[model samples]
Target chain A: MIAKLRQVMLVLAVAGLAVAAYLTYVHYAGVHPACTAGQSCIKVQTSQWSRLAGVPVALIGLLGYAAIMGSLFAPEGEESRLATLGLTLVGFGFSAYLTFRELFSIHAICEWCVSSAVIMTLLLACALARYLLAGGPAPESHSSRYSTGSSGRMSA
Target chain B: MASRTQQKAQARAQRVAEERAQAQRARRQSRLRILAGVVALAATVVAVAVAISAGSASSAPKTTSVAAKHVSATVNRLLGGIPESGNTLGSPHAKVTLTEFGDLKCPICRAFALGPEATLISKDVRAGKVKIVYRSLCTATCGGPQPGAFSTQQAAAMAAGLQGRAWYYIELFYHLQGDENTSYVNPGFLDGLARLVGGLHYGKWLHDRSSPQLAAAVSSDQRSAHALGFSGTPSVLVQGPRGARTIPYLGNYQTYESAIKAVEG
Candidate 1:
């Protein structure tokens, strides 16, 4: 279960990275995401909220995906698993916020933002399922100095 | 007992090695994350800043005002004091007369009015070298005044003229002119505009604007403009002691300057 979850996360992380990269390129090149016919994509992109703290939101997404990929490299243990789950949850939350802003506040839908939101949602769901099914990291095979007395016993 | 001790020592060494590897991986990850984040942040900032600055630079109000001032100065120097007649204001005896037919509701007319024409008036009219006559042509086809509404606006203009405020009303109308023919020409809007030009007797102006004589004058002007090949709201004819010649008075100064010089020559 744990291995399957990791693989899903790895795929999602890669996909997110790719989407983020495209978004970043568009931001720098001043390209509007593809819009439905006759829609005002330029209006949406030029609006104030398209950026956060003076940074293009697309670049922020890129950094987020990179961070998630970095966490994936952590050793298979309780701490690493929790880190992955936590990072995925944060990404889900931020993506949801941006999606809401695009729909209600901006009144313009950006196709790229929607794609990122969808990917983040899938990642969150998979991460949560893996967390539940795996229970916790497999018990450590060898004892160490940090294992005090009987507490070091491998329960699994 | 000795074998057990040796085994414990080897396990400790292995644990230390794993810890060291973990720490190295963590350091590398942290550095990579920081580098990626900084680059991403810088790129995003640069992109956003460039977009915003470009948008603002084109439409900046200050730049527009500065351009307006320069145009005003040039026109004032070139065409000052031609005469004043009815709605037309300029030096009465100036040998060279530049008659401009314009629609208040036309954007292009407004541009010419507020830009090059303003400069011409100050320079030629003030200096008594050239005369400028403005004949209102109600060409508000899309969003300007209706036929009746233009008569009212013209009447209001005539009333303002009676009060020695023709130029003032013309200026105010140019400044506050609304969309052509759209409901922007309603009585309320006109009233507000009249008040801005100092209240002309609305009743009298309304009556005089429909007068046969004013109608005839407007019709005659329209015929003259059409005969001179004017297809648009702003058709200018520069007539001097030299003779009357059509001048291309587009928005830019180069064409306008050449036309003025040609008329002067």
Candidate 2:
């Protein structure tokens, strides 16, 4: 479970990082993301909410995904588990907030934003699962981090 | 006695399994507690990041480029170079004549002027693909209680065309257009626009604007538009070898370019 979960985290981190990176480049390049007519993609990207304190929201997302990816690469320990959990939680929460703003306040949806949000949510789930099953594998099952079937209390 | 000993061994194994299950539950609970604490702390930090970024992100940027709808450096670079005769743009002898029946104050027409028309003139028209002729439908079925100033604005643009700056004046007007039927197109505004066009004889434009011929020219354009059975302002007549046909309004500028392309063929 531990090994498989780390692979899952890595896959999610890379995917989220890709989307955020693309958006960040687009924001800096000042290019529209091929929004069709009557679509709110353009409106959302060009909205005031697109930027944060003179920095494009895309850049912020990129940095966040980068941090998550970095944490995933670190050694599996209490500290690393905590780091991954914290970063993924923050990303997930912020992504949810941005999604809400786009659907409500902006009244439009950027496909890129939606993609990023989905990736963040998935990463959060994976990170949380890893953090919960953080302990080393049982002596009985050397390949698995978690015990299967019936479990008994540890004496110590 | 053997059966009793076997029962005792079974009880010991069951007790060990129960203990292990309880310990696993405890570990799961402890992990959740730690996870909750981490989430809470991270949530606070994330909230602060959002709050700090709120200053720039809250209010939408007012000066958005409006979808590249305005004049670009490319457009400016190509201005005043095209040949103009009366209200026509591009080579006078160009094979295709793209006539736009537009009122200066019509908002839809304004969109055309700002978007597709801007691109068409700069790109297609400049390349001698089509000659765009701007006709003023100053009256007749425009349906609004257009102030007399509307006609004056049209005539003023016509008068500027006499100085070979007709397209220049029209471009400038759309660039600085005011709200419809607002009586905003006064003599002073037109004069300022002419001055802004640069190298256009503003004094001569003022003098020529009063000419009965220029005023009559505007009336003639309106009569021509009405004679064509045009249903409204902001209509187009594309005249090419395929024959002249009305370019049906699609309420967009992109279609305008396609219409021109179809006509040129």
Interface RMSD for candidates 1 onward, in order = 13.3, 8.1
Q: Mind giving the per-residue lDDT tens digits that candidate 1 earns over B104-161? A: 5554566566566766677766777776677766565333336666655655555566
DockQ of each: 0.03, 0.22
- Candidate 1's displacement at residue B204, Å, is 4.4
TM-score, cand. 1 vs. native? 0.44
Using TM-score, give the best candidate's number: 2
Q: List the candidates' TM-scores in order.
A: 0.44, 0.47
Q: Model 1 — interface RMS deviation? A: 13.3
What ranges in model 1 sit over 4 Å off? A1-156, B1-83, B142-148, B198-207
Worst 10 residues of 1 chain A by lDDT: A37-46
lDDT of 1 by residue, A1-156 (tens): 778888888998899899889877755554344667223343345444456655777787888888877877777764566566666666776677666656654556777677788988888787666655554333554444445432443342
lDDT of 2 by residue, B1-265 (tens): 4488657755775786687777878877787788789988988987986787555444322212442234423335657578878788998777788899877765546546756677778787888878989888753214444457666888888888888778777776665554442455666667776766556777788899889887787788878887888755567887887667686342344565566666665
For the predicted complex of model 2, DockQ is 0.22
Q: Candidate 2: where are CA atoms >4 Å away?
A: A36-39, A135-156, B1-30, B53-265
